[model samples]
Target: MSVESGGGTQAVERAMSLLVCFTDEHSELRISELCARTGLVQSTVSRMVSSLDRQGFLEQDERTGLYRLGPMAVTLGSIALNSNPLYRASRQSAQNLSQTTGLGVNLAELRDDRLFYLANFEGAKSPKSFTMAGRTAPLHATGMGKAILAELGDDYVRDYFTKGLVDAYTPHTIVDAATMERALQEIRNRGYATEVEELAFGRACIAAPIRGRSGRVVAALSMSGPLSELGLQGRQEELALTVIETADEISVALGFTVTRAPARRTTTAPKETAR
Candidate 1:
């Protein structure tokens, strides 16, 4: 390879490595920490970080001198969401997940405690699977609905249950307010929700919530199959994670930003480090 091209590639790689170093656990970092994580010379790291800051890919806290992801990253993610590629890939992903697991996949939004499917992909072998793309499913009965409600907090959920608003689609449906409250808390903890024969006998599903740029639960993505196929009764943790990942991908493409604003700051320089 030409020396110039090799140097360009190396610079790109180094910049990307520095970007990935910031994670949920390490949202902000010091120059020394970046050098430690990337194994790049301190001076090289400093130079690249300044370039990234200039490009708006990273922002340094003026007071504390820590670096975190900047607004441009979120803007890029937002742009990707509006691009056709994400929509096409989102549909194909639904189809691929259905094909991979032999399950029906659905994309839905929560409306007044109900799940209204906007798109549906039925598994190859599960042609008979009912598609609710244009229909609504009860919140307490379906995985997607429950997943949405899980993010609405405890008070709203409690009101829903106490008002006798839950529909008992099956004997397994959770009608008790206390029980539903606990389940929602569990969903918050686990980052997903599951329903086994609650919506319909022998049909089970798992779902995850999708957030928008506002960081609110805007929709849900779900997977459904035979109770036996999903192993809902036996082992479905892997399936739950997969469904959550699917929703997360769509959320990212939909311009959902995970970064929080500065912890605390004034128009003047902050007195403390921005968390």
Candidate 2:
């Protein structure tokens, strides 16, 4: 590559890295902190930050002199979420699942190598689960992640597994990419995914993929709870089936037709037995 092209790529990378530095804890930062966190010169950080601010990607408080994510970011995110047909149809299904199972239900979409929560429903029970709407989870450790991966073909799954798995909440999390790939393959065959103490200890989740009109998987519907409340053996299959049914309902609502193959006949009765 030419030096000019490489320099431009590096600049874009650095700017994106800087933007990612803002998180739940440090939602706002000053120029000095931005330079320190990004390891870039103050002049370069200031110029890039100013350009981002002008483009409505970053917001700077006039009095506090702190920068946070801007309105355009929220606007773009809103547009992306609203544009998903599966998410639009699954809102009621998620609520119904939450009510029926008395657990937390969520719809998630796979994006940028992560599962992004699109819609969520909390049961009427007070003081429910702590997960928030719009939260993101790694694709190797959560049921929703597996469900989305199961929808993609084997080649896509292999490429995703090569990216490596980062442990998020628990030690049971599948850190090895190969194992995760195998697990996702099984999930694809089974038509659902289950997470038992993988994401959070004592928490179990079941998810199924929501397909689009063209039979492409677009999102996942999941139900989660504490393991003790959800039995490990008997209830797991039942819960998985429930999630699958709910996902199919959502898919149908979104205009995806479910066509079942005809069952094969095993054997024919003997002619002598007809007497």
Specify the highest-TM-score model's number.
2
TM-score of 1: 0.60
Residue 60, model 1, lDDT: 94
Write one digit per residue (lDDT tens) for candidate 1, span 1-275.
99999999999999999999997569899999999999999999999999999999999999999999999987885565456443444676788898898888888777666776666888864566444544677788878888888888878887877776787878888887777777776676667777878878888777888777667888888888787777754556677768877777777777875565321111121111100
lDDT per residue (tens digit) for residues 1-275 in model 2: 99999999999999898889898779999999999898999999999999999999999998998999999888987887778676668877788778877787888888898998887777653235454557788887888888787667778767776666466567777776577667766675567777888887778877888888988888888887777666645565567668888888898998888787311111111111000
Q: How close is candidate 2 to the true structure, as a TM-score?
A: 0.71
Q: How close to the true structure is residue 235 of candidate 1, measured as C-alpha lDDT?
A: 53
Q: What overall lDDT, based on C-alpha atoms, would model 2 receive against the true structure?
A: 0.76
Name every residue pair that clashes in candidate 2: none
